[model samples]
Target chain A: MLSESDLGALAITLKLALLTTLILLLLGTPLAWWMARSRWRFKFLLEAVVALPLVLPPTVLGFYLLVALGPHGPVGGLMESLGGRSLAFTFTGLVIGSVFYSMPFVVQPLQNAFTAVGRRPLEVAATLRASPLDRFFTVAIPLARPGFFTAAVLGFAHTVGEFGVVLMIGGNIPGETQVVSIAIYDHVEGLEYVHAHWLSGGLLLMSFLMLIAVYALNRRFSVVQP
Target chain B: MTIEARFRIDRDDFSLDVDLSVPSRGITALFGPSGCGKTTLLRAIAGLEYHHDGFLKVGDRTWQDSDCFVPPYRRPLGYVFQEASLFAHLTVRRNLEYGIKRVPAAERKVSLQQAIELLGIGHLLERRPARLSGGERQRVAIARSLAVSPRLLLMDEPLAALDVNRKQEILPYIESLHNDLDIPVIYVSHSPDEVARLADHLVLLEAGRVTASGAISDMLTRLDLPLAHGSDAEALIEATVAGHDEAYHLTHLDFTGGRFTVVRKELPVGSAVRLRVAARDVSLTLEWQSGTSILNIFPAIVDEVIADGEARMTVRLMVGGVPMLARITRKSASVLGLKAGKLVYAQAKSVALLS
Candidate 1:
């Protein structure tokens, strides 16, 4: 059986993951597309930056983000001056943290997908009298379908299971920043073995199902169309 | 009216620079060897080569100039790539409609039905490109381009990706476009057979330069050009179906030169067609030889004679103002006394009907 706090933590974790995944998709699409297609000589520099979250320690990223959202830091200072509270230790802070923590999981797959679409289809559309924007929507998006699926699933799952970034920036708070991973950590630290088992087991099953869905759906897409 | 274009493109490994003015109504073949910048020139005319510097004037509309540039989508033109790059996700019908929907209704000149009927692709409209064969896909691709009713059509080796049988399967549909549509075509090809069959005007390119450009007949017969000296050198003749000899199973084709009897063909009387007479298949005689097996014998005047090598020479003959080439051994030429202004009989042993 779960406590009320456990359910609240689960709900918060789901909500955070959903919001973070949505934001990543909206922001990462064009970024990934540019990374895939642009011919700039220094494009690899931007690629390296986007991939930083993958190689860097999560606590290092979270430490920097925490300072940036703290009361005296640039973002938090700007927020205070704009008549808003500091973003540290809040639900919004957790959302921001998870977005950065899961950035590579969403962007890398989308970039690879966009690259796979290639220049031929876009050039074909152009010759057929389609403008650049029209070609991107009509040709590129539909062709990169599998990439979107992988990005969304990986983003959501990675955010749901995040521990270091969430802990550093979003201290555990019931109904706010108290996500599933943090709740399970609290249970283990307090010697609540049974409670930890239930949340940990549920998370393990959910993550496995999400990954399975991505692989199975992506394979089907490749087989049916490609 | 004519299409006047001047383009200069520079690349690390190659460069293209040329200025041309071609008739706006006939099939003008940009003929060249592989890596001869033929496709690059076609792309420049289509506005796909963005970094090129030049001017493109298609009739009254200027697609590109020093001060202005019209992107490909804004230009009223159709382009068919080497491969039939139909949108894999869309059904054939949707692919055909993709460009038509972009053009306004009043501006539409070619209806979707006309394109479908022209390419004979009515049955494959509901199927996706993946379900089509190579020839079928290319036909659908051509139809998709024609659906937009473009004033100019550019094709870059449209049959290069297909096998020989597939090329034969798609050639008739392409030939029909010349008869049924008024759009001027800039066809890029390396195959001499395709150019001889389809082109009225020829632009020869070599090493990113325009080697020759003129009427196909003139270009193919010019002694200075490589085409005249090649072993496959031939003459193109535009003819009409004069009559059919059912008793002998032969078809009579009447051209400006004269009538040619070939194996029977199922064609209506007065239908226009093209004929290819290879130079090697033609033999010159001092007089009309009676009782010869050859059926096409016409009185020809020797316009020019040039020694091909020590053993052979090519004789250019004029029959009723139409030019023909006859390749004969130097011994035969000497024995027959063939020279300029000499009256002779050109006996054509084989005439292949092109269309």
Candidate 2:
């Protein structure tokens, strides 16, 4: 059986993953849409920036996020100036770190999906008298549903399984910032192999099941497509 | 009412410069070769493709000018792309409702029900676009466009993607649209047969220019135009069903030139129809032969004669007030001394009722 602290960690992990995925979808949709539609000659430069987090080590991303969110740093200093404390070791700080760490997982799938929708359907909507915003909601979003499904799953799962960025910023505060991945690490370091096995085995099974669900559902969707 | 359009587009490899005015009724075809900018011209009218130096006026509304440009969705028009670009996510009924819902209630002239009936797509309402055959999809596409109640309709090679059978299946519905609806239509196509059958007015496009524009009958018989010299050169005639003879199982069609008897058609008597007379199906003779098996013979005057491909010569003939073409051998032209002002009898081997 898992300890009380381990259960608390699992609860915090789910909370953090859910909040992160919601924010990512909110921010990534328009960004991914722009990446899919922009024809600017220098657009590749922005594409490279979005792809940077995918190639960089998690520790490398965590370090910069830590500094930028420290007391004297830009984002934290602004928060302090607004009558708030720096977010360096808070749960909000973990969320911010998980956001950057999981950005590529959320944005890239959405971008690919939007690109696959092509200009033809949008043009058809325009001819049908739909305005730009209406087309975005009705034609573009509905057509890119598979991309959103994959992005949401990946963003949520990757944030849940993350360790380095959470450790760098969250500082393993047991009831607040401490999550499942870090709790498993603590069990392993203490030679409590039973706790480690329980947490690790659960995460492995959950992730595999989520991926299987995605593959199975996406296959059905593709078969319906012309 | 009339549509006046002028557009000048200059791209790296292609440029289209056209200035034209066409009456705002019936089908006005933009006829040309594949790369001759016909589709670009139609897209320009739809505002899907914008030309910086352009001017367009449909009826009394200025769609584009030096200062203002109406975006596609804002324009009072409907456009059908070459492929049936229906939304795969929607059922046929929803696809038809998409544009009509965006339109204001008072401004909607074509009801959703009318469009469904006109295109014969009423039976396909609940099915997704993916489940439709090519002909069914195109009919749905047409109905969707009409549901918007546009003042003008633009179709860009709408049948170019269909198989021969599908095209045959869908073309009559298009004719019904022209007959049942009063909205002006601009049809873009390279197929001479479609133009000869459907177009009341023709705008001949060549290398991004309007070489000529006139009534369909005149355009088809103008000897200098490339349309008159091709293997598919055809003369269009407006006729009314005069009567039907049950004894011979034939129908009599009376046109400006003379009466033509063809195999019986189901069309009611006195119904106006269009007919296609292929140049190759017409033979010119100095005298009418009483022993011939041909059913249509008209006394005509040779309006002009020009050398066609290889050993063939094309002769322009005026029957009553209508002009027709006959492709005869140059040897026969010389032997019969066929020239401008020479009288001849035209024997039509076939007269195809287009509508």
Candidate 3:
């Protein structure tokens, strides 16, 4: 049986993942759309920056974010001057770390999907008197639905399974920042093999189910256009 | 009213430069071979291809000029692409309604029901585009554009993507649009047959320039143009139904030259129709021949005779002020002593009833 602290950590982990996935979707959509459509010569620079997280070590990202959110750092200094405490080791700091860590997971799929949606549909829509914004909502978004599903699933799963970034930013406080990975780590450290086995197995099974669900659903829903 | 346009487009390998003025009624076909910039001209008229040195005035509205440019969505025009670019996620009904919803209430002139009926696509309303064949998809595309009630319609080789049978199936729908609607259509086509059957005005483009622009009747028969010399060369005759003889299952048609005997049709008397007489089907004689099987014969004067190849010649004839063409053997031409301004009788082997 899992301890009370294990349950708390599991709840906190799911909560963090849900919020982080939601935030990534909201912020990454416009950025991905611009990346897909813009004809700027230096677009590759932004593309490389967004893809950095995919190849980057989570600890490196966590280390920079920790400093940025720590007191005397730029962001933390600004917060301090504005009558707020430093953000490091807080839930908000954890969310920020998770967003940066899982951003490419959400943005890359969307960018590919948007690019795959060639300009013909949009041009046809325009000739039919649909404005630019109207075409995006009615034509583009609906056509890229499979990408949305893949993004949401990958973003949620990646954020949920994260360990290093959270360790660097979160203080592993109970009912606040402690998550499933940290809980398993603590159990193993304390020689609690049974608890570690339960948490680790549960995480593995849940992630596998998520990926299966996404792939099956994606295959079922056709993009409807060639 | 007239539509006038001047566009100058500079590209890496090709360029288009033209100044054109065409009447703002019926169908005007941009007829050319491939890569002659006919599609580019159509796009410019629709405001799809933005040219810095461009001028367009349709009726009284200035869509593009030196100081002003209207985007494609704002212009009162509908454009059909080479492919049926229907939204895959939407049903046929929704696709048809997409343009209708964009136009303001006061500007919606063609109702959705009318467009649906015109294209004969009511059975396809609930189906998605993926479920339709190429011909049905094109029909939906045409209907969708018509439902917008555009002041002008631009079609860039709409049937170019379909097969021969599919084109035949869709041609009647396109033909019905001109007869039933008052909107002016600028159609781009590479097929001379399509231009002959559909367009009232013809704009011949070559190497990104206008070689000739005039009525289809004159353009098809003008020996100076390529259309007059090809194996597909045919003269268009505007005739009206005079009478039908039930005894022989034939119809009598009256044109500028004389009366024609053709297979009986459902068209009523006094209704306007078009006739296509191929150059190869016509043979010229010095005087009218009697007791001949050919019933459609007219007294014509040879206007010009040009060598088609080493073996044959193409003769341009004036049949009572209307132009007609004849392709005869060079040996026969010399044997009959055919020449310019010589009186002759042109016997049409057969005349095809168009529209």
Candidate 4:
């Protein structure tokens, strides 16, 4: 009795998670690197800002993102003027919201990883004639591999399980923006226990499997290093 | 060829101001106590630290000058940090090749095989740095640096993190590097023994200033420098193995001034060696003693007798044009009427053979 709408929601959820993870990686890498290395007087200010999403209620973040991506908001107005539509109630809007929702999950791990790498290996690379970019790729990135793994897994899992931000921004549009979490919620509201069981159980199993993979791989990596 | 550097770096607590020019073919040690800015000076020379007014010219090329500075990667130099700091992600072979592959083919002077063999790290090539012993990691680090075929090599207390056994194990490779490689080295160290054994030139740093800079021999025996006043005060003499005395199980060595017979060594004849004659080990005699147990004796002319605080006098002597130090009580100096140009005999209790 599953409808096309349910399958579309599942696909949208996967796409949102993948896109959010990608965007978080691209935007979070340099930010995390800076957070790891900067000794600036106001460094704590930035750290506090990045960590705000971690402690704040997801609904609070969703409410803000909705406001920011609405027609009157700067981002929405910019997109509107660029010959597009308002980001609110769109798949793109869901991705932007998920990226914000999962920002700390990706960045904190990467930042800690980069910081744990210390300055010695980088100095050694420099003396070995590796340019700054070359050193980052050959030394820092490889040494911080565990951090990347953890970040990616956490970002993906966190985005996949997202509900409040998607509900606030994407408005649960069928075939376009309804994600798996919203689908499960809708099924439960309509008193469809069987559908809710399937979607919620799938998400629970997926998240658990992802976490198990991270812990297992991270343990192996650490043992290899040790 | 010479490496001339004039660096002035101002920090919150300390400032490094040094003007040094060392020959481009020998190991020059930056010797000092902890927090003396020796590492900072070396980092500046390597272009790893830029917060300073620095000028560095190596032979015909200018590495850093006013308004012109080369980054570390472009400066054609290899630097070894205090810790081994090997790339954790790369295996030993990849670490060695990291710089080797970056250099232009024509400029690669040290082959990978040669470097691996030189540092005795051929067996460890397949292993990551995490799996290595402290000594093994340091050796690989050295090999990695050497593979770059740098014009200069900068080592900042490369053995500071090693234990005594590890230091002994790595010292020979470093000595060979000093001997075999044509690249000049600027080595930072606080250990006097390392400076004595490895350095041809010495830059003495104290309180962020160049206290003294010269050939190692002159720097070690200078009555004005702190090196000549400590328990570690010793004279470094360059000598060549002359021959072995089969009957007495002794070895004959020749220096610029005279000859010395010490406990035999296995080195081949004519091989150059360095000897450390500690000031405490040297006994002053006004006349040549015939039957004393002390084997090595040399006729020396007193150059100066410095009053070492309290009742002792540090006697500076010129033995066949080579300076030597003898520590004796002021009473002995007065009784012997020791003065400048007074001829004396120096009987050594022990002489260390350093190579």
Candidate 5:
């Protein structure tokens, strides 16, 4: 009993999730690597800020993001001055909000993986004549492969399930910014039980399968130390 | 050629202050007990440990000074850590080639094939480090270090982590490295047996300080040092294989001082060998004793005699030019009137041939 509009929402949700995961990975890798290896006294403060979304209610994050990305806000004013439109209530706004909501999901595993790779291997690389940058790429990245896999799956899945953040920052708009979660909410609000049942059940199966794949793949990819 | 290192490192629990000038050839051992700063010194030389106000010069190149410091990767040196920390992800061949591929082709002193052949790791090239036994892994580690063709090699207790059997298996490879390569090596070891067999020059460290440094034979027999006072007190001598006595199943080795007929060895004639004669195994005699059970009897001139205890004393003697030590009861020393420049004969119970 799902309409064509509902299918459009599901496709947008998948698009947003995939794009956000990719962006988060690109921006978060160096940040997480620094947090894992730096000896600076104030590094913990940055760590706490990255971890805020994990404990903060998603609605609060969404509200703050909404205000900052609106027409009157700093970012929105800058966009207008540059002859562009405000990001609020746009697909881009939803991705930005989802990335924030899922920041910890991508960074925590990466930080743990980088830290677990201790300094000894890097020292060995130095003695073997590997430059610092070469060591990071050839040694650290390969050793932290499991963390990359976990972060990718978790960021994508968590972004797909986002409701509060998306609803606040990206107001529901058919075929534009309406994701599957918001579509299900709209169906329930309109008292259309049959349509809501199909969408909700589909999301349930999708989320469960995504989680199963993450766990199964992680267990298989983890390095077995002698 | 020479290597000069002057450094002072201040740690929370310990401090290392060393200034040394060593020849840039052969194996020079940094010998001391654990926690004696031997490894700290080696790390500083390799540019791995940055001590403030450090100065290092290898040949004419200044590796580290007040205004400039060369990082480990840029410095042409190979360091073997106490553990054979081979790259776990790479196969043995890849690990060996890791350093070889980094240096410019013109600067590559040792080829991949040469390193593999030197360490005898040709058969294990395809194996992963995890699958290797301890001895095999250490050999691969050594081969990997040599692949870079470093100007200087620093080995920090390379055999400390191996079992006795494994140590025996790896010692020959290390000896061959000393004999075959022209690269200068700085080896750190606390085991006297290792120093006795491998080190040509000795740098004795105590409490983060260099106590003594010189040729191995002189360092081992210096009575002023604690090395000569232990239960294992012995003297090292350089000897050449003269010939084999097939009838008696003995090998006659000639040194500057005298000739020693040792139990038959497999070494070919004319090969240089080292021998260690323990003080306890040498007995002093004022005259040549005929019909004695001992086979090693050499004419010696008493060099020095020191009272060790109320009833015991130690006598140092020079048999030809090689130094020999004897621990005699004070009664025997007084009866023989042993003194410097006194002529005597030394009867050795046994001699250990070390090559």
Candidate 6:
């Protein structure tokens, strides 16, 4: 069983993951759609930038983000001028890190799904008197449903398991930024093997079940649609 | 009224340039071989191909000009692609209603019920497009287009993607549209048979240019065109049911040329029909023979004789002002002394009823 402080860390992790997933969904949909449809040659540059966190070392990204959000950095300086404190050690700082860390997981599936929808249905809708915005809502969004599911599941799951980036940015502050992974790290470092086992086992079981559900639903969607 | 268009498209390997004035009623078929820009012309008319310098005016509405351009969603036109392209997520009924819901109430001319009955697709309303056969999907597509109540209809080789059986299944529905609706239709086709059966006006395209434009019958038989010189060359004759001899199962058809006795059909008197007489099936005789197996003969005057091949000659004849073609050998022509202004008997071996 997790101690009271361990339970607090778990709750903070869940809240952070949930907030990050929602923000990523809101920001990624249009960017993924544009990436799928644009013919410009420079589009690959943006795609590479988005996919950087996938191949990047978590500590390196964490280091860069810490600088960018610190008091002397450009973003933190702008926030300070706008009547806000430096975001380096806040819950909002952890969410911003988690969003960057899990972005590729949310956006790649959506881009592939939008590309699969093709241009024919949109052209047909236009001939049927549907405006551009109308076609996006009525045709494009409905057709890309499976992609949304995959993106949400992957985004949420990836954020829940974040470790190194959160450590570098929001370092082990109980009830504020200390998540389950960091809490388990503290348990094992302090020679509490039983507590570490409980937290790690629960994390493993939850991740596996979420993955199984996503795979099952993905197969069902393909069978029903194709 | 007419649909007038002028388009110039420049591409890397191909280009299209044409000016057209087609009738604003019935069907006008754009007939050409593949890669001859027939589909490009249709797309331009529908406002789908925007990367072109073009002018289009249908009836009194100017869809595109030098200073103005209307997007596809705002144009009052229905376009049917070669593929049916039905929405995979929607039921057939929902697909048909998609276009109907977009048109304003005052502009709604065609009812959903009328469209459904015209295409005979009521049984398919609840089914998704994935479950439909090719013919049924295309019928539903046509009905969906009609439900929009477009001012003009554009079809880009709608049957090109179907097999022969499927094409046969959908042709009657397409034929009925001209009679049931007053909308003008621009149809693109590579098959001559489809153009013959459906077109009121024929526009022949070749290498991105209009080679000939006129009535279907005139275009089919004009000596200057390649249509009359092919082995399947035939002349179209308009006839009406005159009388029926039920005792012998024979039907008499009246045309400007003469009376034709054919196998009896299930048609009422005075009903109009089209007849196709192949040039190879007609033989010229200097005099009518009473004792013969051939039952149909007409007295015609030879108008012109042109060499068809090395050994064959095609004789054009005027039978009461209706033109008919007879292909015979040059030796036979010379032996019979067939010439212009000479009176001859045209024995028709067989005539096919088109509709």
The candidate that wins on DockQ is: 2
lDDT of 5 by residue, A1-226 (tens): 7799999998999999999999999988998899999999999899999999999998999999989999988887788789999899999889889888999999999999899887877887898889999999988887788889889988998998989999988999989999999999999999998999999999899989988988887787554332
- List ranges where model 3 is wrong by over 4 Å: none
How close to the true structure is residue A134 of candidate 5, measured as C-alpha lDDT?
93
lDDT scores of the candidates, listed in order: 0.92, 0.92, 0.92, 0.90, 0.90, 0.90
lDDT of 3 by residue, A37-152 (tens): 99999999999999998888989999999999999789987998999988898999999999999999999988888888878899899999989999899999888888888999
Better of 1 and 5 by lDDT: 1
Chain A TM-scores in order: 0.98, 0.98, 0.97, 0.97, 0.96, 0.97
Alpha-carbon error at B241 in model 6, in Å? 3.1
For residue A73, what is the lDDT in candidate 3? 83
DockQ of 3: 0.77
Candidate 1 per-residue lDDT over residues B77-110, each given as its tens digit: 9999998888877899999999999988998999
Q: Candidate order by TM-score, highest to lowest?
A: 1, 2, 4, 3, 5, 6
Clashing pairs in 1: none
Please give, for residues B1-355, the per-residue lDDT of candidate 5 as tens digits: 8999998988889988999998999899999989999999998999887887799999999999999899999998988888888877788999898888888898898888899999999999988788899999999999999999999999999999999999999998999888788999999999999999899899999988999999888888788887876778888988999999999899999999888998899889999988999988899888899989888899999988877768877778888988888888999999999999999999989999877
lDDT measured at residue A219 in model 1 versus the true structure, 0 to 100: 88
Q: Which residue pairs clash in candidate 5? A: none
Enumerate clash totals for all models, in the order shown.
0, 0, 0, 0, 0, 0
Chain B alone, TM-score, model 5: 0.97
Ranked by lDDT, the better of candidates 5 and 6 is 6
**RMSD after CA superposition, every candidate:** 1.3, 1.4, 1.6, 1.5, 2.1, 2.1
Give the C-alpha miss distance for residue A3 in model 2, angstroms: 1.6
Residues B220-327, candidate 6: write the lDDT tens digits: 877888888889888888899999998999999999999888999888999887788899999989989898889889999998888998999888888888888889
Q: Tell me what TM-score chain A of model 1 achieves.
A: 0.98
- CA-based DockQ, model 4: 0.75
Please list the residue runs of candidate 4 whose C-alpha ends up more than 4 Å from where it truly belongs after superposition: A1-3
Candidate 2 lDDT over A1-226, as tens digits, reads: 7899999999999999999999999999999999999998999998888888888888888888889898988999999999999998899999999988899899999999999999988988998899999999999999898899999999999999999899988889999999999999999999999999999999999999989988887887776667
